[model samples]
Target: MRRYLPSLSALHAFEAAARYMNFTRAADDLGLTQSGISRQIRNLEEFLGATLFHRSGPRLVLTETGANYYRNLALTLDRLEEISIDAVRGRSVDSSLMIGTHPTLASRWLPERLGAFIGSYPDIPLEVMPAMPSTDFETTQLDVAILRGVGTWLHARSIELFPEVLAVVASPALIPPGSKLDPLQFAEFPLLQNAGRPSLWLNWLRLAKLSYSGRIQGTRFAHHEMIINAAIHGLGLAVVPTFYIRQEVANGQLHMPFGEPVQSDDSYYLVYPERKFHNPNVIVFRDWLLRSLRKA
Candidate 1:
């Protein structure tokens, strides 16, 4: 057995230098002077009884042994880092309840409803993760996700929260005086599109049994908030989700021209891994969420 277990500092220095292939750059990355990095690498090389670097005029090249050792050491260190992160996050993963949601839902809906949940379960700490629609829930530490889509997630139990309804809306200033425009007249205005749901305007039009070619041409935004802003700025008419824009409408920032909303196939859903259903926190959150939705 080789009696050399290299110092962790030296090993770290060697790994940094090996990755950059330049001592000065490695030193900058490690927040150490170039000389300090060089000494650490030398110490590591001596301990291993092998030459790790071939020093030229201003460049350091890895020897064959150095290359092989670095490959193994880099993999080992990466695994160790992953393990450490997993260990730390494991405590939260097991005890802390994480809820992932879309930005609009988190900002407009969840905050108002979470008070009751927090009050009911005083012992459980809730962590809200506002994530993108493309976030992978399995790899993430999130225990549950509230997503806006048709309930079709794989390997998870999903409960429908509510049906999403959308309508053509704009600021009061945008509605022209003496303009008694019906749903069909919506084609005349500059339409705004939600980039995430590009077909929203079309779907609403289809539901209304009206066909207009101009629905495809419009300003597009990735978030519901941006669409709301555009409508509020009198930029154009937007087909916005009713739940998200309720406050804006109530506050007179936005106006709904139509009497009825266009119902969408899309719905809000609460999803959790099947195995996590037994968790006490998950059970409490699911029950609270269902109750709140019912009350709403």
Candidate 2:
């Protein structure tokens, strides 16, 4: 580490501020006062010798330099978090939870809401990894997993956080308002694909009574957020879990083409090995997760 490298505290404040574009919200997320958040960002700007934000009458907008810096810094922070967790273990006995989850929940859902959970349990840092549909108790030393499935996993205890709801969403440019679209009408736009569930489109089409004359062709992405971003960019239509796209849909960046919500046979679940079911950390997280979900 060099003395010239920006401090992690200042960088973290800027990253949260950049992501939300609001100092007050960022301050709340970081558990700092509004003035404290502004001070930290100002310190970072001075250290970098470039203006990161244009503070315009109560609105904090990122400058071109800040926008570019934020983008790379965000990725850097994610990798740093992963590396930090991997290189270290619990600071003391029962002080952390080794978590496993899919990218969509981790990226779109957890990071934003994690501040509250951390604020409550500051001692138990989370060491998170990408998890499979079924937790690998034999191969991995994970304490818990957030998986998307029906309310069952062999040899594991589980609970459903919420039922998975899906919607056929795409960029509004692809499907304008008041368009009377038959099920097959959607085929006119290319279908984006999720590698985890290759048959998602087929099943949804079957339920919706849609038939396509042409082949469904589009890019395949491993993460749900990737497809959703592509859909927002007008690349193709995507059948995605509703929870993941609420913000985008609400912001009018994405539109529902079919105007009907699809209920999936599965849902998001928190699972852990039955043998370690009584672990205090796991139990606390499970309770907090369910309570938080209810509150949300």
- Writing each residue's lDDT as its tens digit, candidate 1 over 83-142 gives 776687774335668899988788888999888888988888778987654544434446
Each prediction's total of clashing residue pairs, residues at least 3 apart in sequence or on different chains, is 0, 0
Please list the residue runs of candidate 2 whose C-alpha ends up more than 4 Å from where it truly belongs after superposition: 1-90, 211-214
How do the predictions measure up, each by TM-score?
0.68, 0.67
User: Clashing pairs in model 2?
Assistant: none
Against the true structure, whose TM-score is highest? 1
Please report how far candidate 2 places residue 96 from its true position, in Å.
0.8
**Candidate 2 lDDT (Cα, 0 to 1):** 0.82
Residue 127, model 2: lDDT of 77
Predicted structure with the largest lDDT when compared to the true one: 2
